[model samples]
Target: MPHSVHTRSDTVQPRPAAAASRGRWTYRLGRWLGIDVYVHATFLALLAFFGLRAGLSGGAGAGLEQVAWMVALFGSVVLHEYGHALAARSFGIGTQDITLYPIGGVARLNAMPRSPGAELIVAAAGPLVNMALAFVFALGHTLSADAGQGAFNAAGELAWPLQFAVMNLGLGIFNLVPAFPMDGGRILRALLATLGNRVRATVWAARVGRVLALGFVVAGLFGNPMLMLLGAFVWFGAGAEAGAAVREEQLLGASVQQAMSRRFLTLSPWTQLGELAQRELDMTLLEDGVFPVESGGAVVGIVTAEALRDGLHDLGPKGYVADVMTRDILCVRPSDELSGTLRALHGRTLAAAPVVMAGRLVGMLTPRGVAAFMGGPQLRHA
Candidate 1:
């Protein structure tokens, strides 16, 4: 299968604007192997709420112990996601990052292999890692002779290794349940793909996933609120996965040249920010607009309307376009395919990207341009 992602270097990429802002609410624990691990704000809330509850029920020591147990449990989750990331890496795929939520952990891969064998291996890796951990803990339990004494209790009185063993075993088994966006679901899809088309296999798998999700909802109503939330996550995730698969299939046939805007507004390097702001206010609503900065008939950089406005308050509107524009401009060739460019633009902060040919700006591809290509109105009014 053809890949759509390309890596420039090993240099770490800063979080896209949205993720950077989300950082105000989340805690980044650390990074390893080029993968930044983040703890979502909600996960922290979980720790606080559970710790407080445990403290009120028992004492301060109980609170601390509960929090420590949570840390250890989430550590296993991190390891589980890394299992997937490393396996995907073996296939030459890149993982953007790994994030841990109260529900679970996710490793965001650049792309999944369309090949069934590759998919099976990547899907199975997470559970296999958990199973391996479970085995190691079981061996520890045997060696330490703590297996029969207080295993799988939430209280600190139980042996930690036994707690790890039980949790890992349960996690490995639970993940094997047939459901979309889960390891077992991927395995099912891979097996189904072996018989025929991938899209068709995805549709069938999604259908089964939805049915199983409904079962989860029913079980959650009678069992646990956590199970209900898990059901909703699986429900939405399965539907989203199906939609993404279809979009990727359509994008595989699209070319950027067919959708790029040949005419667009451009600013000179020496253009004052005041002039740019006046031009923007004189034109249509430019809140979400981005303009190319050109010099000597070549695209030099890109500037955003928000960035210009923000610079005005600091620089008194006298700054040149050169001072405001981003020099690290990312451009796509006119002939580049839609899927690949889309991959490049994913999670990026830029308002628009230049379409260059032979180092000359031929056009631009904005969010509107992409929307137009994706079957919406062709908004080319420059």
Candidate 2:
């Protein structure tokens, strides 16, 4: 299953907008089918830890073998994520990237499928891949056994192929345990959505996931550390999903114009940072940290207060605003739905986005603006 909870694609953080979109700690493993693949640093640590543990218990060969198995297992996980990505593609949803973590692989879809039927198909695709892999492995084992090549050697331990087959089978079944954050949980939500109200369906699915999480925690208490970790992940993931659903419902029917800041400061790209600081002390300016850089009646880029301050310290007072501004701006239309805008801004590091219409900048949208709008009567009615 594509582990979507808190994945890099949707995990928002306050930082410099100029920073690269990729996770800082992850290493690129190249792109496949236009989707960038990354491996988290912790995944390497996991491999090292397991290999060392196996080496301590058995020998160098055993350690190498264990490492190989781990690689194969995660390879299967990558394929599982690809299954989800390909299925979503059929529904016109693009996957941003796939990242491998210690827990699993995550395929960050650009957006959730708009229809419940499409969602169901996308969610089920991951587990179906695992099931297919398991079947192939099982068949391979059976064929080998029929040819007198037993699945076990003189040590009576199952061969790696047989073990891999069993592992894939377990993976497929476990992911189908109808709980939130899992493919099965999404399947359950999609089914419930058919009864009306996607928000209500998410709530019910979250409730079921939390109950199952408690069960996993209880089962882990008997001696399974992995089960405990999985339980915690499910519990938190369910809560996050439920909360997001509620927020989306609240923002429904609202547009960017309703919440955007119409009155704000705009700086010329050629303005010196030192001069800007002096002006800041001389007059009362917009309290929002972001300033749109405008030139020739067109918004060019954005400069944050933090960036300006840093520029003054690093480049003395002579540094131009253009040097500190982020040129690759994320702009939204005033007529765009607030809910969808928020989704687009979710993982972006920008403090605000320029609201543009017909090639003209009309206003700016910031977190503070959104918060104020959320507390207003319009959102209450929504």
Candidate 3:
């Protein structure tokens, strides 16, 4: 909880970095157990397609009923993700958010449990939730056979309980397939990590996953676009996971002070949008045309290029930099390890981080600087 100050003498110029956001398009379904649930845009399209197809086949009533079943399926998917979230929580790993996609639910954990035993529990919990749901639904269908009708309704639509049971079973089985970003692959990684290096374990697991994905792609060659897409996702996801594992290992011995940029520009809180607008016109001198906002020689916040442009349009060039700056941003210490620093920057919009120590502005850390250090020569050696 202690803070560190960043100084100008430690500055290192930043490099280029890529960025993207997915949470923006998601619709919040609800929050529980201190976690938010989101349904992705594509999920709604899936529901619309299923409902329309059912309407064409059976009518409005059938469409509504089919929609209900689909809802139950997604509800089960949400439950499955919750299983992972809760289990990860038990290990002190917080989830970022849970997002439901057309294929299934994804529990985005803030960080994965490095302990093999902890990971095993988290990975297995998801499949177990589906199995439990399958059991409950199967029991309901059996008990309601005489009263509510199990298999066929008067409209010939498959009844809810039985349908849900089968769907849950399928979900459980499908997720157990060994592929990256899936439970089975995580399970595999954990098991292998128990026997050897974590990075090496990830590489082996990724290889297995890519091989498994190839089989799916082969099967998809005949048809099954969904499976083909899933296979492609698995292949790429596995490669990414492997790369992340290796990257983490490489940065383990490095510290933030070793790579943070000390030569970056700063903006004054009193600086008007006109200054930033002018700077934006010739951005060759600034990385990403963004600068940390300093007030009274202390880093207060950051002013980004986009904010400056927007301010210029809305408030004209007279808008103060403070008006467009993002305040209350997370700061890093000079002594912090590079890996922890990178984790702090995860899912953040602004890739630049201000380093502070003893309540004084020190230097700025940027993803480009980190990347350069990792991929290029060491500063002192160079």
State TM-scores per candidate. Answer: 0.73, 0.76, 0.72
Winner of 1 and 2 under lDDT: 2
Measured by lDDT, the strongest candidate is 2
Tens digits of per-residue lDDT for model 3 on 1-382? 0000001111133212311233445788889989888888888988999999999999999899888878888888888888988998898878767777776677767567778888888888988899999999888778768865548888897776777788888888888787765788888888998996999888998999999889888888888867787788788777767776666577888888987878777778898888766665556544354578998877889866767778879998888988888896778899998776665565354466898999977888775677667664322100
Off by over 4 Å in 3: 1-20, 139-160, 262-285, 289-336, 341-364, 376-382
The candidate 2 region of ten consecutive residues with least summed lDDT is 5-14
Q: Which ten residues in a row are the worst by lDDT in model 1?
A: 1-10
The residue-by-residue lDDT of candidate 2 on 166-241, one tens digit each, is: 8888778888898887888999999999998999999999999999999989998997877888899899888877
RMSD of each: 6.6, 5.4, 8.6
Which candidate achieves the best TM-score against the true structure?
2
Which one wins by TM-score: 1 or 3?
A: 1
Give the candidates in order of TM-score, highest first. 2, 1, 3
- On the 0 to 100 scale, the lDDT of residue 330 in model 2 is 85
